[model samples]
Target: LDRRSTFAAEVCGCQVEIGAAGAMGAAAVVEAAGGTALQACDAAATVFQNIMGSVCDLVQGIVEIPCHSRNAALASMAFLCADM
Candidate 1:
């Protein structure tokens, strides 16, 4: 139970940190591109949605199955979002 709790905390922390960083980066890009507040926020929303955590409990509870692909997907999504 403690391990699960710790995992949950780590997941929550990543969500907050990555989401905020992406949002801020999106906003900055939008501003630099001469976009309005609404546009910036919309871009940030797209980023946030894309960067949300992926499922990490696949393959009969085997840890590696989910860890690699899930984290890779998250990183790719973040890059794609930033490019958008």
Candidate 2:
């Protein structure tokens, strides 16, 4: 929940869950799955950095157009980050 992310959401607020909030949840999942705290944090930070932007403009009131792809990509990425 940094200003840049908040601003990105405010500027193009569509799927709030698919953004920083999603990454935060991903981190907790990593930690719960026996990942180290640092790993969890790294996963979350990397996810946040990867998807961080006012890119919610792609979510034009639907899930088919890039939203689903973004979610899948990030969800998969969280595990990779944890492993790394």
Candidate 3:
């Protein structure tokens, strides 16, 4: 987690001039699951894409629909894929 957070912060700082929001927590979990920094990032992007694919801005409000669960599943799958 710590390493991820640092890497995220560094990336954000270098790229966008802003501090990272959830990079640390994300990084920690990925690292704990035995992912390298590059792999973790790729996995994260896959997870994000999976979630975003199902998200919708409804007439009443923004809704995730099936994206949240899908993202979680995809994240795990991505981690496994990265390992391989």
Candidate 4:
């Protein structure tokens, strides 16, 4: 039980860190493309929604499952959003 709880916490923390990194990436991209950071962030959010497609929350309480993939996807999306 303790290990499970720790895993959950770690997963949650990773998710939060991913979000922050995504935001920063988006800002950088937007700045590079001559767009506003807010607009880039909005685009990133849309990209996230499309990529995740209603699949929210981790299943089996495993962080390595969707969390890892989503984090990577988010980083890519941030770059794409900034370019657009």
Using TM-score as the measure, the top candidate is 2
lDDT score at residue 33, model 4, on the 0-100 scale? 76
lDDT of 2 by residue, 1-84 (tens): 655445353455534556665577668778888988887888888776777663654555764567677777777776666556
* Candidate 2 clashes between residue pairs 3 or more apart in a chain or in different chains: none
Count of backbone collisions within predicted model 2: 0
**Two-way lDDT contest, 1 vs 2, winner:** 2
All models: lDDT? 0.60, 0.67, 0.43, 0.62
lDDT of 2: 0.67
Per-prediction TM-score: 0.53, 0.61, 0.36, 0.51
Q: Order the candidates by lDDT, highest first — what do you get? A: 2, 4, 1, 3
| Segments of candidate 2 deviating more than 4 angstroms | 2-10, 13-16, 54-64
**What TM-score does candidate 4 reach?**
0.51
Give, for candidate 4, the lowest lDDT window spanning 10 residues.
Answer: 1-10
Residues 20-58, candidate 4: write the lDDT tens digits: 567567767777778875787676665544443334466
**Index of the highest-lDDT prediction:** 2
Itemize residue pairs with steric clashes in candidate 1.
Answer: none
Alpha-carbon runs more than 4 Å astray in model 3: 1-26, 57-84
lDDT (10s digit) by residue, model 1, range 1-84: 134333252556444455556666777777887878887888778877765664345579665565556455555554455457
- Candidate 3's residue-wise lDDT over 1-84, tens digit each? 245444342333321111122233345567888778986676555444433323233434533433344445554655454444
Candidate 4 has an lDDT of 0.62
What ranges in model 1 sit over 4 Å off? Answer: 1-11, 55-84
